[model samples]
Target: MRSVALDLGVHEISFCEVAGGAVVLRRTVRSLDSLEDLLGPSSSPARVAIEACREAWAVHDTLRNWGHDVLVVDTTRARQLGIGQHGRKNDRLDAEALAHAVERGGIPLAHVLSPHRRAIRHQLAVRRALVETRAQYVTTVRGILRACGHKLARCTTEGFLTVLSAAALPAETRQLVGPLVTALEMLTPQIALADAALEQLCTHEPVIVRLTTAPGVGLVIAAAFVSVVDEAKRFHHAHQLASYLGLVPSEDTSGGRNKQRLGAITKQGNAYLRVLLTQAAHTILRHKSGDDPLRQWANAIDERRGRHVAVVALARRLSGVLWAMWRDGTVYDAQSAAVASAKGLRLQAQSIEQQAQSMKEASVKARRRQRSIDKGLGATRATARSRPVSTSRRASMH
Candidate 1:
C-alpha cells in the first residue's frame, strides 16, 4: 500500500503521498475539508501518518472512516523522522519527510483512544482548566488581602466566596476585589456540575469504579486513569502501565562501560494524569487515620530516603497497583499485601533500630574522647605551674 502524511497548520493543511519509495503527489490545502480533492476515497487504502497534536487524532479518525489506516506519530519522536533539521522547518518539508518515514515504516505511534473515551478525556481536561482558572483568581484575591494585613481562613473552594463575604473588610477592599469574588462565585457551581458529570460517568463506567477500590484512587483519579488508558488489556503488566504514565525513572545508557544514566521521570505522557496521580499519592501519605501495607511500605522508604522521594515512589507503585487491580478484576486486598510485605517491614524496622543504636554509641564515644582530652589538658596545666617557680630562680637573683 502507498503512504500519506498530513501536516495540519493553523490556516493551511500540507499533505504528501508516496508509493514505492517515490513521491506520488504533494499539495497544500486551505482547510481539512479540502483534503478530499487531492485523493479519491474509494482508492486503495493508504497508510496515513500525522504527528500527534490536538487535531491529530480527529484527523486520524476521519481518515480511518474514509478507508485508510492512520498512524498518529508520537510527537516526542517526530524529530527522528527529520521533521525539523538545521534551522529550517515548514509544513511542506514536514509533510514530505513524514510521508517518506511512513512509507519506510517503523515510526512509533501514539496511543489511540476510542471516541467515547476521547470525549471523557476532553471533558476532564475542560474541568481541569476551569479549576485552575478559579484557583488563579482565588490566589490573586488572597494575595491582595495579604498585602493589607488580612488573611482568609481555610475553607473549601466552593465556600470561599461565602467566607470572604462574612469576613470583616473595609469598603474599599471589598470594592477592589469585587470582580474576582464574582468570578469565584460563578466558578464554584460550574465546578460542582462538572464533578456531578464525572460521578455520572463513574456510575456508567464499571472499570473506573473498579479502579477506585484502591486506596487514594478517588473518582477523579480513577476516571483520569480509565480515560487515558482506554483499555486495560493494552498493557501486559503493571510496570508497563506505570512506565506509560511516565512514573518510572528515565534512563540513558551509551558508550564505554554502558553506565546507565538514570534521571527524573520522562514526562513525555499526559501531564494532567501524572499530576493527578502525584496528588493522590500525597493524600494517601497524609491520611494517618488509616494504615495499610501500602502506607507501611511508603513509610519505610520515607525513613530511608526522606519523604519527597518516598511520595514519588509511592505514586509510581500506586499507578502500578491500580493497573494490576484493573487488569485482574479485583479490588485491593489489604490483608494479602500486608502479609506479603511483613518480612520487608521487619527488616526495615531492624535496620532503623540498628542505625539509631549506632548513632547513640558514636555519641557516647565522642563524649568519652572529649573527657579524656579535658583530663590531659588539666594535667599539663598543673605540671607547668609546678615547674614555673624553678624556672624563675635566675630572675629572682637579678
Candidate 2:
C-alpha cells in the first residue's frame, strides 16, 4: 500500500508520499485545500500518518473523509523512527520520516477521540477553567483575611460568601477586599451556568450516570472519565484502561533471577482524570475503608504501606472498577463477597430506589448541614450582600 505522511503546522503542512520504500513525491502546501493538486480524488487511497497534536484530529477526519486511512502516530516514539535524529529536524524531514515509518509499519498510534467525545472534553475544559479561576479568587480572599487576623471557618466554596457574611468582617477590611468579592459574585452565576450546561449533557449520556455508581465517584469525575476514555470498548479489559489512565506501577527488570525493580506509577496519561480518581480513592478510604472487600483490600495495603501508597493502589483498583462497570454495564456491588468478585463484576444490577434506600440505611447521619462543599467549587448564586450597595455598584450590576 502507498504511504503518505503529513507534517501539520499552524500556517502550512509538509506532505510526503513514500512508495516501494522510497520517497516518490513531496510537496509543501500552505493549506489542506491545496491537497487536490497533490492527492486528487481519482488517486488510489493511501495510508496517511500524522504526528499527534491539536491539529491531528482535524487532519485525521479530513483524510478519512477523503477515503484515506489515517494513523495519528504517537509523537514521542516517532522520534525514534528518524524524526529529529542527531539534533536535525524540519517539516520536510519530519514528513519524510513519518512516511517511512508508516511504510515500515508497527508505528505507535494515538487514540483519536470521536467528534462527540472531543466536544465534551472541550466543554469540560471550559468548565474547569471557570472553576479554577473562581478558586484562585477565593484563595486570595482567604489569605487577605488571614493577614487581617480574621480566620474564616472551613466551609464549602459555594458557601464561602455565606461564611464571610457570618464572619461580619470589619468595614475597612470589607472595603479593602471588595473587588475580589464582587468578582466572586459575578463568577458564581457563570460557573453555575457552566455546571448546568454539563448537567444537561449528562442527561443524554447514560454512561456518566452508570459510572457514578462506584463509591465517591461523582458527576464531574464521571464526565471527565467518559470524555477522556470516549469509548470503553476500545480498551480490551480493565487493566488496559488503568494503563491508559497511567495508573500502573513503573517497572525495570532483567533476565537474571530476582532482578526486578518496581517504582512509582508511570503517570503517562491525563493528569486531571488521575487527580480526580485519587480524590475519589481518598474519599472512599477516609471513612469505613473496610466497608467492603475492595475497600478492605485497600485498607490492608494502607496498613502495610503508607496512606499515599494505599491511595494510589486504590485509585488503580478504582480504574478497573470503572472499566468493568462500563464494559459490563453493571453498577458497583458493595454486597458482593470476596469469592464472588474474584471472577467478574462482583455487582448485580439493582433498582435506583433500592440502592439509595439501602445506602441510607447503611450510613445514617444527622442533617444539620443542608449543603456540601466540593473541591475548588463555590456557591451557585450570590446570597445576602456583604456590604451596603453603592450607586456605582448598583449601576455596574447591569
lDDT of each: 0.75, 0.78
TM-score against truth, every candidate: 0.81, 0.82
Off by over 4 Å in 2: 34-36, 39-44, 255-257, 287-290, 337-398
Q: Count the backbone clashes (under 3 Å) in each candidate.
A: 0, 3
lDDT of 2 by residue, 32-105 (tens): 87987655556688898999998899878877877888999988678678999889899999999999999989
Q: Give the CA lDDT, 0 to 100, for residue 344 in model 2.
A: 37
- For residues 74-137, what per-residue lDDT tens digits would candidate 1 score against the true structure? 9887888888977679999899889999988899888888887877787798779889999899
Q: What shift in Å separates residue 9 of candidate 2 from its native position after superposition?
A: 2.8
The TM-score of predicted model 2 comes to 0.82
Candidate 2 residue pairs in clash (backbone atoms < 3 Å): 157-378, 158-378, 158-379
RMSD of each: 25.1, 5.0
